[model samples]
Target: MKNKNVINYFKQVHADKVEYNKQMARLKELPSDYQVVYKEVQKFLWEFTAGDGMDMLPPMLELLDFFEEGAANNIPVLQLVGEDVGSFAENTLHEMQAKTRINELKRKMNERIAKKISKE
Candidate 1:
């Protein structure tokens, strides 16, 4: 079952690769004016891929989380690495906030219990 999921994911990824190659070839055949647009698009993609420090941290953490979860769940290949590009940092921040909230709740509950025991 997991193998089938992996195979299907790769199939879709491969199809996207084929489509990207076709687009590049079409771009290559375009006139000089349009070639400049393609060049700018390539530049933007490069910048997006090679993001800076804080940008790098979120994806790294996300991969770790996905791996830990997958390992515990007996799943192969999380397939989360390249699936997110635009919202990587945003999602990680949200996860971090949720973790902090969980910790805060635990701390408050512990404090309340301690106060109740002291008054008894």
Candidate 2:
């Protein structure tokens, strides 16, 4: 996440604090692998967040719920993300990135660069 957005996010937490706390408690109850993947993915994805990452919240919460469901069902964590687990997180970030304003800007930037390079 952008540093400015991260700071803004923390500042806005008073409203979401209860829900966030509940998620954290659910996190604590997760299996170790789920916990590890969740933290790593969160850090990776945070770097891609735009506008306080408000748009990213729903999917992040859904991820925690997915992990919790898997754990409750006795499903192996790797089964959820697959082998080469880090890639799972990376792929997840890429998916989430698609919905952010930054990604749209990035698309436009690449298009501009391509056009300029092509002398069109």
Candidate 3:
């Protein structure tokens, strides 16, 4: 059973890697403005990434898809994401329900504060 689990893990990893490569290739085909904005937004998202960072992959992929669509529709990247890019990035994180380092810190801080108060 353990051996089967190991094989499945490797297989899933391989599939994910392949999909990521295809996404990257599609990203490259987008307009220059879209490419730049997408990369910047992606980098911003990773800044708050937690755990092994695998939690970020889905959101990143979704962002890439949006960018690709914007490019296809000839829409300006800035218009799609709005002037406040960081806000857009935060919104994306919320929309995806992805956990980040900030979320972890918030949880820990609240828990510790509650514990301290309860002991009083």
Candidate 4:
């Protein structure tokens, strides 16, 4: 019975994740301000999760901060629905750094090739 409950709980969590993703998609489509978006997201988290949702707030706020900053800078915010914001941010930064490193390596290779061609 305990095992059954655990499985059911996880199933519910998955369903909630899907619903949250759908809600997020719709929210992104509407015109919104930071506070409004924050509240809506907070409410959604509280509604879906069994816990108090406080643990999730910090990361959610971080993501909201990113959204606000992106909007101010005229940069597009990456929409990551149903993801942990801290993990998402960490992963995104790593991906960006990797891309930068790749580009730098490519530039160096091209420069070396150019120099060799010039010598020839």
Question: Which one wins on lDDT?
Answer: 3
Error of 4 at 99 (Å): 44
Superposed on all Cα atoms, the candidates' RMSDs to the truth, in angstroms, are: 18.0, 5.8, 2.5, 15.3
lDDT of each: 0.48, 0.79, 0.83, 0.52
lDDT of 3 at 6: 100
What TM-score do all the candidates reach, one by one?
A: 0.36, 0.68, 0.78, 0.33
lDDT of 2 at 55: 61
Instruction: Enumerate residue pairs that collide in model 2.
Output: 1-46, 1-47
Ranked by TM-score from best down, the candidates are: 3, 2, 1, 4
Which candidate has the top score in TM-score?
3
Root mean square deviation (Cα) for candidate 4: 15.3
Residues 5-112, candidate 2: write the lDDT tens digits: 988867777656767777778898998888998888777777777766656667789889888888999999889878887788777776663366568689889999
C-alpha displacement of 2 in model 2, angstroms? 24
User: What lDDT tens digits, residue by residue, belong to model 4 across residues 5-108?
Assistant: 99998897777676556545644643365345455555544443334333343345455556666566754333423235445444443433222333556788
Q: What ranking emerges by lDDT with the best candidate at the front? A: 3, 2, 4, 1
Off by over 4 Å in 4: 32-120
Instruction: After superposing candidate 3 on the true structure, give the runs of residues whose Cα lies further than 4 Å from its correct spot.
Output: 1-15
Cα distance off (Å), candidate 1, residue 102: 25
| Model 3 alpha-carbon miss at residue 72, Å | 0.8
User: Lowest-lDDT window of 10 residues in candidate 3?
Assistant: 51-60
